[model samples]
Target: MNHFFRKPILLITATLFSGSIINAQNVGIGTATPQLGKLEVKGSTGAVSAIFYDQSTGVAIENNHPGIGFNSYYNGGRKAIAPGFGGLLGMDPASGKLHIYTAPASIATAGAPMLLTERMSILANGNVGIGIAAPTAKLDVAGNLKIADGTQGEGKILTSDELGNASWQSGASLVPGASIGYGTWGDCATNGNIGAYQPLTGAAGVNNFGKSVSLSGNYAIVGAPFETVGSNYSQGTASIYRLDGNGWVLMQKLTDATGAAYEHFGSSVAISGQYAHCSYCRRPRRKWRAWFCNHLSIQWQHLAAAKNYANQPCKPGFLWQ
Candidate 1:
């Protein structure tokens, strides 16, 4: 009687275990039916689908490659999973580095539809690489980089203002044929003659012409300090030119009526409405003279003259009145 009861109990337990396996068929964590995968979890819109956590210790799931991964069907088809169709975030088992991988949209094998290509990688040393497999620096890029600010173009320069704001601006270039011819007063008056009728024979860079320049309205004054007068060298002079409809035209040449060599009479010049000023500084004695310019006749007249007292030791001055 005991043997008969034991056999029935053991047979009943085996039957119940078999039924439990059949009932547990495809397990769905959040859904009634598990889809193509063995385990399926569905999430609400805008919320995380699933989270894997370990309550025993702080360390969660760890694997050589991706411990958990995902896949989707291709072209909205439900028959088969897409080939090379997803992204994976994982850590290297050896180096302990995090890596982001993606698969191309091409079919390779049904078992392994696509090969995982590392798109971005962060090494254990904290170096990152984009489009580069291995990065040796904090940030490394293997492709071209472009910077745009909406108003930048070729032949422009990046400039910064006083407040440290940066922008692009036009670069400097030469104006097309905008040259102004200038020379010594004696050279223009008598066809380059320095003395009684001697032709000017000075070479380029020898005469310090254009030492001073001033502009007023449509008139411009240029100075030549190394001009020769009679038999003296460096008897400075200034020339005034007017801008007509044609261009810059020679107007008049100005010099001290009683200027001597080494005076540098036109070392500095300034021009205003109808007046012009020129300075002559020769150690121990500084002379400043004002001239009244007649634009109509293109003539210059010495208006007033002042001489600095050597003992006064005043500032190197100019006469404007």
Candidate 2:
């Protein structure tokens, strides 16, 4: 005699859990029809549908394939899963590298391998890379970067402040037919010659105090190529002046470190901003040396120097042009 036993099933329907239904075959919470999978949950509009929590290792979602997939729907219609159709965020366990990928939106095969193009990454050591796999600096980018902080626009360049913060600033503007012209010399009686400036200590004799002069903004630099220094004849000096309420005041005097006779330390001078360049020519040797000075304070600070003879190559410190 053949005998068969039937398994008993228990079905529970609760009204408190938003019409939760439980049966021997499947479980459905917040839904009545759980036909999609063994367990299905449906949430109300604009509310969370599901949540996974773990304190130790965090929540994990897995698929039978390589990378985890995320599905999105619009009006109950599934979007095409393609290479460029979606974005991917992944971490390489072997190399400890994190990568973020992007692609164009196009139709592709679902569950098939995608040609993921890495657009950004973060190394295990905390270096962030953009459009690059490896980053040597804290923030490294392999492509052109645009900073639109409201100050960026056409004809603007990136500039940095004293603290290294960057911002966009307007470039130098040139006016049409703009040129600087000098006035008549030795005419202090008129505006032609603003005022006569001379070194109080070196006014004893002829010092060639005005041999060379350069003006930038409100500052002026005068070169005295024949000024004597303690017994060093014609050692040369450069005097810087600032235009203040009391007229032009002598700010600082610059001279070469080496007080050798006939060095002509300030035969040529050029001033720009808070810096000045003093150059001297050795006509006999057909050579020249130039020194840069920072006059941010009342004192002059030597910044850089370059020396070259007619037969030798110039050093890197100073540029003639």
Candidate 3:
């Protein structure tokens, strides 16, 4: 995060044989005198440097770097041109990572993937990692999956700053300009333009096709509606897909995990680890949106409701073990 602080004034006396008056902006030590705009500082061979500013805008122009300049994307505002950091050139205070999001939004921007968010790609040796990085830190956040630009036009890509000697994996999607989602082992990119999430070909389809998806560890569960999953509501059919490799593998097509699936039942779902809690709300004269937990089993655990659950009357909130 950007920070600005001012230290309180402290006074000290000089016991020098030769002395001169020291101004608030000037200092005199021994036989040396220094000033902000005049006196120079030489660190090494190229240490002594001067910083010039724009007469009109007062922007920094030392060497070839710009710091804290004016911006006009939204309202022609002002932002900082960050120096190199976090393996690249910027750090996102929100996530404490050195990546592109660290760039001020006035420039093109996108949401970075959180830890445990997986991204795949085709590496240089035709393996996986392409012209990017894989999430290798805690939760493994690789800069391979692209951060999507949600605008009608293309969005800016957050490049993979990992300089390594690893081969590429097949279909590694951690490119800089993809949608963002929370599914590792598969594909999930940040839809940069709109900040929306786009999951790759895996367990996400089951969750995204109808209701929202819940993730636990490496597993994600989605409630497949009869309309989306093309299941027979009359026969009470619900499906759950497991994440395998870089794609989704259908685990099973459930029937009556909640004893009997209601017309529009199975709306909201929450997944954790291997547990998936879902709410089933019948349609038309829907009475209640009862919840059930498909604990990776054929049976379902009915959750308590506030009586007469409507269309997703309440979500299934969970606590970690």
Candidate 4:
């Protein structure tokens, strides 16, 4: 029974085995068999580079409280995941928190995750909003964004998506002579609401503009520089349509407010609000563009076309480029 030192070797083996069990307990994990006490681990050194605790091969230390049984150490720390492609599964965006995903099938509100998202950006209230993105999209919430529903646009909503061209929506009140659609906001009251898409050369010629495509209010006053110097802006006619009980109904076709013709589009009516304002380029390029003032006589003698004017403040009758 007492050969040499058999008991000492047995004691050494027992001590090592006991140490493994104690380590597992500290990490709150179960042993090889289920229902054992939790196993835990502490960092020997203060700093650890790796984030998540790897337990793929580690033992499942047992837990005896409520709910699910086994527990294992997962190194979900402050940052959650690498900055590269972290999702809701990432560590907390805030400090001292861990991100957790709720069970898909189970009704655990523990960590409710939003569906249909590759990555989630936190809102001001810490709630998540859904956003589909393209490759060229940037990831940031630069400023305040508003969301509204059920509120219709203030005026006439002219959509051109059906026409396969530039779509536009103008207010109910339009003005006369204002050549809308890149040309000019054919005359209207208040400020000319630019149509969605306008002609680059709508003011003087046709299809003769290389300006970058853009959108403006009222009449879609597009590419032309500010000062178009011409006497006759009568060629540009403004038509008004109302959305009736059935469909869009043409209300009126105002050929001329002064009953005279200027340049085919001369310095005619500029559309704004629900009216038009037109004047001689020589008068005041800004005033004549979108002003809707009551006047019987549009003196052709005073009117002139826009020649060289670009980017100016829009008045009641005009819009700044």
Best model per lDDT:
2
Q: State the lDDT of candidate 4 residue by residue for 1-321, as single tens digits.
A: 667755544434333242344433432222343234354333321122112324221112211111111112223221221111122333333442222232223222311322223333433344442242112233343345443344345664544322233333443456698554334343332243553331122333532222212221322222222222334433343333333223444444333334323322223344343334443222333323332332123211222233325545334333222
Q: Report per-prediction Cα RMSD to one decimal.
A: 20.3, 14.5, 22.2, 19.0
lDDT for 113 in candidate 1 is 42
Give stretches of model 1 more than 4 Å off: 1-205, 282-296, 309-321
lDDT of each: 0.56, 0.62, 0.37, 0.31
RMSD of 2: 14.5
Q: How accurate is candidate 4 locally (lDDT)?
A: 0.31
lDDT per residue as tens, model 3, 1-321: 999999999999877644233464454332255554333343211211233333222222121121222211111222222221111122234443332222222233211211111123322233333223443333343334443344223332232212322322123335587554453332333333333233433223333343545666435555554433334433233455644333455555443443343444445557665455545544444444445554525334534443462333333341111
Model 4 per-residue lDDT at 8: 41
Best by TM-score: 2
Arranged by TM-score with the best first, the candidates are 2, 1, 3, 4
248-296 in candidate 2: lDDT tens per residue? Answer: 5788888776657777777778998778998875445536777888864
Error of 3 at 11 (Å): 95
Worst 10 residues of 2 by lDDT: 57-66
- Write the number of the candidate with greater lDDT, choosing between 2 and 4: 2
TM of each candidate vs. truth: 0.33, 0.39, 0.29, 0.22
Which stretches of candidate 4 lie above 4 Å from their native place? 1-117, 125-267, 272-276, 280-321
